[model samples]
Target: MSVHETIEQALVAPSYLAGGGDPGWVTVPLHRACDWSYGHDPLMPRVILTSPDQQATLRIDPDPDEPWWTVRHARCGDRPAWSATFDARTPVEIIAALTDALTAPTPPAPGLEPYDLLRQAGWHTVGEGLISPGRIAAIEHYGGEDGPWFADARLDQDEGGLIWRAYLSNTTPPHLIAAFAQALADPTPVRRPVGRVPAPAREHTLTRTVHLPVGDVAFALEQRVAALSARRKDATSNTHPPRSPRVPPPRRTR
Candidate 1:
C-alpha cells in the first residue's frame, strides 16, 4: 500500500511465523521520518523508520531470492519485537504512509516553539545546497528559522547491493540520522541485481559516527551574555551619570 503501510504490515505480519497464535500488532503512527539515497542493489536498501513512541527502529533490506523484503526491528523501549520480513513493490506508498501515520493524534507540546520541536524531535537544520564531501558539516542550533544540519549522501553499488554513506549534521536531536540508520537497515525490493561489486567508491564500512552537541546556540549565547553582565556589575559600583532633578517653584498656596 504505502511505505508506512508496508512498514506496518511488515511489523504486524501475522506473528504466526514465530510460533502459535499471538495478538497481532495493530497499526500505529511513525512520529518521526527520514530518507536517504539508495541505488539498485540486491543486498541492503537504504531506507528505514523509527516508531513514534521512541520505542523501535525498523530497517528494510533488498532480497533477490525472497518474495518479500526482509525487515529488521530493534525495540529500543521495553517492548520486545522480533525482526521480520515483508514486501514493498512501490516505495512511494510506504513513505507517504509514514508521513500520514506520524501526523496522527499525539498532542503537540504546550507552547512548543520551533526550537523545542526540533530539539524534542532530534532534528537539525542545514543551509540549502551546502552538502558536499569531506567538509565538516555546517549546521545551526536545532529549531531556529535556519536549520541546524544537512546531509550529502554518497551511494555505491557493487555485485552485492547498494551501500550508502550520508554525512549528516543537525541540531534537531539528530532525528535525520536516526531515520538514515533505520532506512539503511530496513528491507526493500531489489530493483536491480547486485551489479558488479566495485571497490566501495568511498572508503567506509557499515557505519559512520559523528559527535556534535545538539540544541540552541542562541540560548547558550544569551546565558553567556547574562553571565558577563552580572560579572561586570559585580566588578563596579553603580557609577553611571547621576540623575538630575528640577525643583518646582513653591506653590502659592492660600
Candidate 2:
C-alpha cells in the first residue's frame, strides 16, 4: 500500500501517549474534541473549520510557502477580534494547544501574565523566548512590547536550520498563548511517522505505532451532517406550514 495507507492503518505514536506531532494531532481533536463544522476537499490538501456560532474559523493547509494553520475570531460583545497563525513545520502539539484553548467551553480567564504562564509550565527564560525541556522547540517574543509572538523548532545542523515557526499578534488573547506555553513545556513526545517527522523530533528515540482508528473522524462527520439536517428540516417545516387536506366538490351526485 501507499505511505498514506500505512499511516491510516496505524499512527506513529510516541511512547508517552500524547498525540504524535503529526498534523493529525491538531486536525483530529478540532473535530473530535470540539463542535466546529468541518469542510475539506480531496482535490486540496487543506481543511476549513468554522465555529458553531459562526463567530470563528480555523484552517489547516500544509503548503510550505504559506501558513499551515490559522485561527480567526469575529468580534463578539466586548471581545475584540483576533487571529493566530502557524507556519508549515510548526510542531503539531503546539498548534493543538491553541485549538483546545480556543474551543474551550468556558472563556479563558482574563489578565493572565504570559511570563507566569510559561513559568508554571516549567519553561525557563532563554533571553527573548523560552526553550522546551528537550531543547528542540522554542517560543520567542520580538519587536518589543508591541511585537508579535513566535514559536519554532530548530536543529543545530552543520549550519543550523529551523524546523518550523508560528506567529501570533500581540493582540492575541493571553489564554491562547498560555496554552501554547504549557504544551511547549510538556515532556511527552509527540507521535510522528518514522520518515516524515521533523528533523528535531526524529533525533529522539521513536516509539511503536498506535492504532487511531479512522472511524472516529468518520463518526464525527456523521454527527455534524445529522445536526445540519435536523436544523434544516426544522427551518423548512417552520417556513412552509402543512397544507390542509383537499376536499372534493360535494359528491359528483350531478
Candidate 3:
C-alpha cells in the first residue's frame, strides 16, 4: 500500500502507543526518530525527486563552480536507508524529470515515507520523489540551498503535539547551539514577527508543528550559527550603549 493508504489505514485504525498523544497525529512525532544525512554546506540541501522516479534525493551544492554537491538518495517504498554522495552536480534537466515523476497520476509505490506524506498534504518542492526524511520528520520548507533554516516545525491537535529536529553540521560558537536548542525546547515565538503580513489575521496559530529529525536539528543549529556569524561583521559596525555608570559609595565610618 502507498503512504496515502497507510494514512487512511491509520485514520480508521486504533491509535497505537507513542510518546505524544492521539495516534491520528502521532506519525509526525515517531517519524522524528528516523535519521537523515546532509552535505557540509552551511545551508540545508535542496531535495529533488529523480526522473524515472527511483528514489528521493537531497542535494546540496554550496559552490556553483563545483561539479557536484552532496546527494543523499533514498528509494521509495523502502525503509529509511539511503545512499549519499559528497560531490555530484546534477543537470538542470533532472528537475523536469523529477516533476514528471512525482506529478504522475499514480505513484509506483502507494505507501510513502514521511517526506511524501507532507507533499501529499499540499507542500511543494522543486522536484518530485524529492522528499527527504528530514523534510517529512520535520516540516522544513525553503528555497534552494540558501535557506531560512527552521529548527523545528510541528503540528498539534487539541494540545497534542509533535516536534522536529532541524540541526545543521559544522558549527563553532556555543550560543548558537543554545539558540537552536532553545527554539526546539521552546517553540513559542514570544518575540513578534519582524515584518508585516500582507493578509489579515487568520485563525492559524503563530506556532506550527514541524517534525524534523534529530539529525536535521543538529544541522539546522550549525546553519543558524554560521548565518549569525556572517552578520557579525555588519553588526559590529553598529554602536551600542555604554555600561551603566555606577554611583559613588557613601563614606565609611572612621
lDDT minimum window of 10 residues, candidate 3: 8-17
Which model, 1 or 2, shows the larger TM-score?
Answer: 2
Please provide, for model 2 over 1-254, each residue's C-alpha lDDT reduced to its tens digit, 9 standing for 90 to 100: 33243233223333222223456566555665455788768899788988789988889877767887888888888977888887765666677678767766555667546666656766677887776555656678777677778876555433246666678877777788778766665556554444555434544434555644455533544554455445546656877899999988886655
**For residues 32-94, what per-residue lDDT tens digits would candidate 1 score against the true structure?**
112222234545544455553443344444454542322233444563333333333322223
User: What CA RMSD would you report for each candidate?
Assistant: 22.3, 9.1, 22.3
Over 99-213, each residue of candidate 3 has an lDDT whose tens digit, in order, gives 2232233333434443444455444453422322223223232442333233232234222232222333222122222222222222223211122211211122243233334
lDDT per model, in order?
Answer: 0.30, 0.64, 0.29
Question: For model 1, what is the error of residue 176's alpha carbon versus the real structure, in angstroms, after optimal superposition?
Answer: 21
Please give me the total number of clashing residue pairs in predicted model 1: 32
Ranking by lDDT: 2, 1, 3
Candidates 2 and 3 compared: the better one by TM-score is 2
* Ranked candidates, highest TM-score first: 2, 1, 3
Best by TM-score: 2
